[model samples]
Structures are given as C-alpha cells and as structure tokens.
Target: MRVIFAGGGTGGHLYPALAVAEELSSRDPGFEALFVGTSRGIESRVVPASGYGLELISSRGARGKGAAGKAVTGAMLAAGTFQAMGIIRRFKPDLVFGSGGYASVAAVCAGWLMRKTVVLQEQNSVPGLANRTLAPMARRLYLGFEKARGYFRRGAPVVVTGNPLRGAIKPGPDRDARKDFGLSGDGPVLLVFGGSQGAMTLSRAAAGYLLRRTDVQAII
Candidate 1:
C-alpha cells in the first residue's frame, strides 16, 4: 500500500497522523508512507524524526496582515498547491491521510484531484479551518469530538473517533501522588505545564487563584 500523510503546525495534528501511518505499516509491511508538510512548520522536524520521508512545500498562513501580505500568502499557497500536486504525481499514493494545517490543506486537495482516497482526522472540540475546508473532498473524516460532525456538509465523511494519543502517561489515582510529590495537605496543590492546549493562561490564572486557597486539592 502506498500511503501519504500530510499534516503539521502542531503535535496534536502530527502525532495522530503518524500513529495512523504506523498502524498502516503494521498492517502491511510493504506499505510505503510519505509525509507532506511545510518546511517551516514543526512537521519538518517531527515527521522525519518519526522515520518517514517528508516532502516539504512552502506554506504560510494569512493573519494579522494587510492586503499585500494576504496577496503574497495567497500566491505562496497556490504555488504550494502545485508543489503538492507534483508530489502526488510522482508518489502516486493509493490513499492520502492527514490531520489539519495549511500543509494538510494543499496535500489533501491535490490527492483528491488525483483520484486518490483522502482520509482526514479532525482532532479538536472545534474543527480547525484547514480540516473543514478539506472535509468535502475527503473520502473519510475522522473526528475527535462527536459534536463537530454537524459542521460538515451532507455526504461528507464523518467518523467520531476519540482523540488519538501517543506515549500516554497515566499516573495511578491510588498511587498517593501527595506522598510522591512530598506535599502537605495544609495547602492547595497546583500543577503547571506549558504544552497543554490553552494551558498557559489557564495554568497561570489557576495557580494564582488557588495558591491562596487553603482547601482545594487538584491537578491542572
């Protein structure tokens, strides 16, 4: 099987796409997997690190810019679309899978145009713009949240698959985390991590609000 996965911009999108690629490889050892992503995004690093050959297309989003910037971004997007087509023509994948990002946008569109099956994974409570735009062209759309299904048009592929996670860490609830952290029960417990979605703002606010609370015990 020849499979191509195009996704990037964040680990949330890239990780699941990679997981699917891994599964595909396991199902068929003869499978050939290729990843398409922007040279600028995190996918360039993460995709190759996952041991897949990555084809980089030039892509940039239009945001917080004037008309000139938007025009330039549009031109870049069009050019990258052509580049994606080129990749598809050369690779001739049987199917293409992606998550969500500008990178996925170009590749999925090209794959659809080339008469290849396209599968997309939309992994958020609210589907991202790229995934939504590419949804109609997709043969299958895997979703993380069920509520997001209505957003797609009629006959669009919508599968409610819970979030695909990797290298998950689940600390036992009965493990007595207080003892592990050497904490006292006199004060509230505050946990902070920078990487979680919308986490920084919530973590800071939670830390500030609960640090003074003498009764709360939780994880953030």
Candidate 2:
C-alpha cells in the first residue's frame, strides 16, 4: 500500500508520522511511503535519513502573525495545496495521513478534495488550528490525549491511540545509559531537549534552572 504522510515543523508534528510509517513498512515489506512537509522543517533532514522520500511545499504558520503576514501565509497555503495536489496525483497514494502542523494543512485538503481517504493524528491535548480545520474531512482521528476529543466536532470518529513511538525507543538500564553519556555519581540527571527544532524559550528556562543546581548533571 502506498501512503502519503504529511506534517512537520518540529519533531512533535513529524516523529509520530515517521514512527507509524516505519511500523507499516516493517509489517509489510511492500509498503511504500512518501512524506510531505516544508523545506524549512526538520523533516527535510530527518525523512531522507530515515530512508523515505520527501516532497516539500510552500507553507508557514499563520498564528502569531500580523495581518500582512497572515495574508502572505494564506497565499502560500493556497499555492501549497496546488503543489500537494500535483504530488498526490503523481504518487497516487492509497491513503493520506495528516499529523498536525502548518505543512499538513495543504496536503490533507488536497487529498480530501481529490476524494482520497484521509486520516489525522494529533499529538497534543489541545488540537492545533490545522487539525481542527481538517478534522471534518478525515475519516478517522487518532489522538495522543483523550482530553483532545472534546475539541473536535461532536460525533467525529476519534480514537485515543496515544502517540506513535519509534521502534528504536525502549527502556534500557539507567546506569548503563548514564555511563554511555560519561555521567557518574548522578545526583539526579536531567535531560533537556526542545524537540527536533529547538525552542529558545525552553532552552533558556532549562539553562536558568540548571545554573542554580550544582548537584544536578544534565544532558542538553
């Protein structure tokens, strides 16, 4: 089966789709997958490395933008939809899966307009604007949090699937893991990460907190 996975700007919006695609490929050796995202997103780097094809579209976040910026974003989204439609036509995917992000908006809409089966996966308790807008077009909605169900339209085919995790992730011995990182005598090791596209605010906060604690070892 061929599938088009759309979404990416950060790891939060991208990784789940990758995890699902990876699982599908493993389960079915003949499974084919293509990723749709913006060139600026982390997917540009990660997708190819994961051995999947990626198609880039013109898109950007409309939220927190000024009127002029929002207008420009809208124009980009319209263009992106057209670009996605072209990709969908050429790829002829059996299914189009959308993970919430600005990049998914165009691909999902294009797929729905083309009368293709569309599915969505939302990884946050509060749904994003793209997912909320496209929820009506989806045949199924998979959510990371059960509380997110209330945000979509009533009677929507919502399923609480939690978040898709990569197969490579598994529990390992804490001491061994710490040793691998060259950390010894751990007085509670703190690991701080801001997803694929790092968040400056989160990094700053972590930095401030770590500065006050000498007993804590961190992997940033």
Candidate 3:
C-alpha cells in the first residue's frame, strides 16, 4: 500500500511522522511511504536520510502576522494546495498522515478532498492551527495530550495515543546512559534535551539553574 506522510518545519511535527512511517514499513515490507514537506523545513535534511521519498511543497503560517504577512501566507498555502493535489493524484496513496504543522495543511486538505483516508497526529499540549482545522475532516485523530481534546470539535474520532517517537527514543536505566555519556552516576542526574535544533531559552534556564546549584549532575 502507498501512504503519504505530511508535516515538518520543526522536530515536533517531523519526528512523529517519521516514527509512524517507520512503523508502517515494518508492518508491511511492500508498503511505500512518501514524505511531503516544505523546502525550508528540517525535513529537507531529515526525510531523505531516513530513506523516504521527499516531495517539496510551498507553505507558510498564517497565524501571528500582519496583513501583508497573512496575504503572503495565504498565497503560499493556495499554491501548496495545488502542488499537494498533484502529488496525491500521482501517488494515489491509500492513506495520508498529517503530522501537525503548517507544511501539512495543504496535503491533508488535498487528501480529504480526494476522499483518501486521512489520519492526524498532534504532539502538543495544545493543538496547532493546522491540526485543529483538519481535525473535523480527519478519519482519526491521535493526540499526545488529553488536554487537547477540548480544543477539537465534539464527536470527532479523537484518541489519546501520546507522541509517536522514533525507535531510538526508548527508556532505559539512567545510570547506564549516564555512564555511556562519561558522566558519573553516583550523584543526582539531570538530563536536559532541548529538541533537535536546541532550545536556547531552555538551555539558558538550565545553565542558570546549574550554575546556582553546582551539586546537581546534569547531562545537557
């Protein structure tokens, strides 16, 4: 079966889609999956490395912008819709997974318009605009946080499946991980990951706290 995975611009959106794609491939050796994302998104680098065919689409966010910015975003979204429609027609995918980002808006809409099965996965405490807008049309909705249910329309087929993370993101003994990282496991351990690109604000806050408390053993 052919499937299309759409979403990017951030690890929050991209990683979940990757995880799902991985699962799909594992389930069926013949299953084919294609990734749709914007050229500027991290997907340009990450998707190809993951061994998935990546298709580029033009998309921009419409939220938190002035009139001009909104207009530009709208135009981009329109163009992206046409591009996504073309991809959908050519691919003839059995299913389309929307991973929640501005990059996913057009693809998901196109899939729905084409009457293909569309599933949406939301990874945030609060659903983003793209997911919220597509929720009503999605055949199924997977949410990372239960709190997000209230944001969607009632009677939507929402399921709290939590975030779909990569296979490498498994839980293990902290001490072993610390030792592997060349850190002593004898003291308190603080593991801080600031996403793929590194969250500067979170890094600074963690640094400030560590500076104030030298007794804490941190793996940032």
Candidate 4:
C-alpha cells in the first residue's frame, strides 16, 4: 500500500515520522512511502538521505508582528488547502499520515475530504494545532504520549505507538564512523552532532569539556 507522511516543523515531528517509515520497511520491504513537508523544514534534508521521496509545498504557521500578519498568513494557508488537494490527486496514496506542520493541515484535510485513510502521529506531550484540528476527521491517531489524547477531538480511533524512529539512528559505539572522519584512535572520543535536528549547544559543551581533560583524545 502507498502511504504519505506529513508534518515537520522540527525533529520532534520528522524523526518520529521517519521511525514509523523504517518500521514499515522492516515489516514489508516493498511498501512505498512518501513524505510531505514545507520546503524549508528539516525533512527536506533528512528524508531524502534516508531514502524516501519528499514532496515540497509552501506553508508557514500562523505568525505575525500583529493581527494583520496572522490574517495574511491565514489567507495563505487557506489557499494552501487547494494546493494540498492537487498533491493528493497526483499521489493517489491509500493513506496519508500527518506528523505535525502547517503544511500537513492542507494535505491531510484534502485526503480526508477525498475519503482516503488519514492517520495522525502526535509526537509531543501536547498535540499541535494541525493534529488537533485534523484529529476528529482522521481515521486513526497514533500518539507518542497517551497524555496527548485528551487534547484531540472525537471520532478517530487512537493508538499509542510511542515515537517512531528510523532504525538507522542507533546510540552506540562509533568505531566504524570514526574511521571515516579521519581521526586518531588513542584518546577519549566524543561524537558531537548539532543542527536543526539536535541539541548542538549541549553536545558542543560536552565535547569541549571532554577535550580539555588531560586523559581524553578527541571530538567529532
């Protein structure tokens, strides 16, 4: 079956969505999955690298310097609804899965309007606005935290799947990856990753502190 994943403001949404994709892949290698997110969201980068096709749309959350700004953004989102419908028609997916993003609202709504199955995966302790609005209309809801359920509207069946994560993300020894980065293997080693997808400042601090130690060897 074909599936589309929507929602991606942060790693909170993108990461969980990817994890679910990975799980489906493990279970059925032939399942096709596509991801939909704003052109600027982290998913544009992470999803492709993970071997998933990504469809882009112009969408931004409601924000403004004042009420006027929110009003204009709301107008854009309204237009985006039709744009999302076009995507659904072209994709012809059996199911649409929403992760979390303003872009997703349009896409999921269009899918629901078409009577295609729509599933929501809530990643935060509190369900975000897009999911909240779509919950009543979706066919199924999956949440990272059960506590988030009380926040959704009635109608959809809810399931607690925890946060879906790609199997490629593993916390373990870096002996293999280290060899590729061109570093000596004599001292204490630390892997530092920071960007939109992680806690860069904390990793930087920890690596810096470790490097200063007389016993330690390196940081990545």
Candidate 5:
C-alpha cells in the first residue's frame, strides 16, 4: 500500500509519522510511503534521513498574525494545497495521514478534496488548529491523550492511541543508559526535555528545580 504522511515544523509532529511508516514497512516490505511538508519544517531533514521520499509544499503559520499576515498565510496555504494536490495525483497514495502542524494543513486538505482516505494523529492533550479544522475530513482520528477526545465533535471518530515512538527508541540497562550520559552514581537521575521544539518556560523551570536540588542529576 502507498501512504502519504504529512506533518512537520517540529519533531513532535514529524516523528510519529516516521514511527508509523517504519512499523508498516517492517510488517509489509512492499509498503511505500511518501512525506509531505514544508521546506522549512523539520521534515525536510528528518524524512530523507529516515530513508523516505519527501515532497515540500508552501506553508506558513497563521497564528499570532495580524490581518495582513493572515492574508499572506492564506495565500501560502492555497499554494501549498495546489502543490499537495499535484503530489497526491502523481503518487496516487492509498491513504493520507496527517499529524498536526501548519505543514499538515495543505496536504490533508488536498487529500480530502480529492476524496482520498485521510487520517489524522493528534499528539497533544489540546488539539491544534489544523487538526481541529480537518477533523471532520479524516476517516479516523488517533489521539495521544484521552482528554483530547472532548475537544473534537461529539460523534467524531476519535481513538486514543498514545503517541507513536520511533523504533530506535528502546530501553536499555539502567547502568548503560546512565553511563551514556556520563553519570556513574546510583543517585536519582532526571530527564527533562521540552518536546521536539525546546520551550523556554520548561527550561527555566527545570533550571530552578535543579538549583534547589543539586542531588538530582538531570539530562536536559
């Protein structure tokens, strides 16, 4: 089966698609996958590195924009949708999967317009604007958090499937994992990360906590 996976801008929006593609490839050697995203998105680098074909579309975030900016964003989204439609036509994917981001808007919209099977995967507790707007077009909506269900339409096809993890991520021996981080002690170790795109708030909070508790070794 051929699938078109669309989403990017951050690892949070991109990695889940990669994980699903990896799993499908593992199960069916003949399965083919293509990724659609903006050139500026993380998918530009991540998708090719993961050994998948990637098609770039024009897109920009409309959030935090003024009237003029929103107009420009709308133009870009229209261009992106046109480009995505071309890609979809040429690729003829059996399914189009959307993870949530500005990059997903065009491809998902194109898929819906073409009457293709469209699916969405939302990774946050609060659904993003793109996913919320495209939810009705999706054949199925996979959510990372159960609480996210309430945000969608009452009868929407929402399924609480936790975020997909990459095949490369696997738990190893505790000592080995600690050693990799240069921590040899048996003391408690803390892992702090602000998702794929680092958050200033999380960084500041973690710093304050670490300062108060020097006993805890953290990998940020």
Candidate 6:
C-alpha cells in the first residue's frame, strides 16, 4: 500500500507519523510511505533520514501573527495545497494520514479535495486547529488523549490510540537509565522535556524542582 503521512513543525507532530510509517513498513514489506511537510519544519531533516520519501511544500503558522502576516501565510498555504495535490497525484496514495500541525494543513486539505481517504491523529489533550479544521473530512480520527475527542464534531469515528510512540521510548531499566544520566540509581528518576525545541516554562520548572530535590535523578 502507498501512504502519505503529513505533519511537522515539532517532534510531537513528526515523530508520531514516523512511528506509524515504521510500523506500516514492518507489518507489510510492500508498504510504501511518503511524508509531506514544510521546508522549514523539522520533517525536512527527520523524514528523509528515516528512509521515507519527503516532499517539501511551503507552509506557515497562522497563530500569533498580524493581519498582513496572516494574509501572507494564507497565500503560502494555498500554494502548498496545489503542491500537495501534485504530490498526491503522482504518489497515488491509498491513504493519507494527518498528524496535527500547521505543516499538515495544506496536505490534508488537498487529500480531502482529491476525494482520498484521509485519517487524522491528534497528539495533545486539546486538539490542534489543523486537526479540528480537517476533522469533517477525515475518515477516522485517532487521538492520543481521550479527552480530545470532545472537541471534534460528532460524526467521524474517534479512536483513542494513545499516540504511536517510537520504539526508543519504552520503559527502560531504571539502573541503566540512571547510569546513563550519571546518577547512582538510588532515587526517583525524572524525565523532563518540552516538545522538540524545549519549553522555557518546563525548563524553568524542572530546574526549580531539581534544585529543591537533590535526591532525584533527572534526564532533561
């Protein structure tokens, strides 16, 4: 089967699509996958390295921008929709999967316009704007958090898939994990991270926690 996985901007959006692509390849050797993302997104680097065909399209975030900025982004997105349509026509994907992100917006919209079967995966407690916008067009909506389903319209089948995570995230041997962090493995281990670029708020909070608790071992 041929598939197109669309999403990017951060690891939170990209990695889940990668995980799904990896699983599809593992399950079916004949499965082929293509990833569509913006040239500026992390997917530009991550997707090709994972051995999937990567298609770069222009995209921009609409949040926290002025009217002129929004207009520019809107034009970019329209151009990206055409690019995505061309890619879809050439790839002839059997399925199009969208992980919620600004980068996925055009691709998903293109898939819908082409009358292709589009699926969505939302990775946060709150559904992202892209996913909400495309939900009506999606054949199925897969959610990382159960609470997210309430945000969508009530027609599509929603499944709580608990986020398709990479194999590297499995429960590690605490002793080994601690040793990797240069800790003695005698206390609790805290794993702190803010999405892909790292959140300053989370960093500050983690720093404060670490400062107060000398007994804890953390990997940040």
List the pairs of residues colliding in candidate 2.
none
For candidate 3, give the lDDT. 0.90
Residue 123 local lDDT, model 5: 93
Which whole-number lDDT from 0 to 100 does residue 130 have in model 1?
A: 92
Considering every candidate listed, which one attains the maximal TM-score?
A: 5
lDDT of 5 by residue, 1-220 (tens): 9999999998889999999999999999789999999889999998999999999999998855588888899999999999999999999999999998999999999999999999999999989899999999999999999999999989999899999998899989898888889996678998887854447788889999999997899998
Lowest-lDDT window of 10 residues in candidate 1? 166-175
- Residue runs of model 3 more than 4 Å from their true location after superposition: 195-215
Each candidate's lDDT (Cα)?
0.82, 0.93, 0.90, 0.79, 0.93, 0.90
Model 3 Cα lDDT, one tens digit per residue, 1-220:
8999999999889999999989878899899999999989999999999899999999987765688888888889889989999999999999999998899999998899889999999998888889999998899999999999999988889999988878988899877788798987577778788664347888889999999887788878
What is the full ranking by TM-score, best candidate first?
A: 5, 6, 3, 2, 1, 4
| lDDT score, candidate 2, position 62 | 84
Cα lDDT tens digits for candidate 1, 119-202: 889988788889888887888889999988888887676889887765443556543878777676566566755574587788
How well is each residue in 1-220 modelled by candidate 4, as lDDT tens digits?
Answer: 7888888867777888888888887888678988888877788888899899988776788785798988887777767667777877888898998887676887787788888898888887788888888887787889899899788755459888788667766776667656766766666565565554347777768767985787765544
Global lDDT for candidate 6? Answer: 0.90
Check candidate 6 and list the clashing pairs: none
Better of 2 and 3 by TM-score: 3
Candidate 4, which ten residues in sequence have the lowest lDDT sum?
Answer: 189-198
Write down the worst ten-residue block by lDDT for model 5. Answer: 192-201
How does residue 208 of candidate 4 score in lDDT?
71
Candidate 2 lands at a TM-score of: 0.85
Runs in model 2 lying further than 4 Å from the true structure: 63-66, 182-192, 195-220
* Every model's TM-score: 0.83, 0.85, 0.88, 0.74, 0.93, 0.91
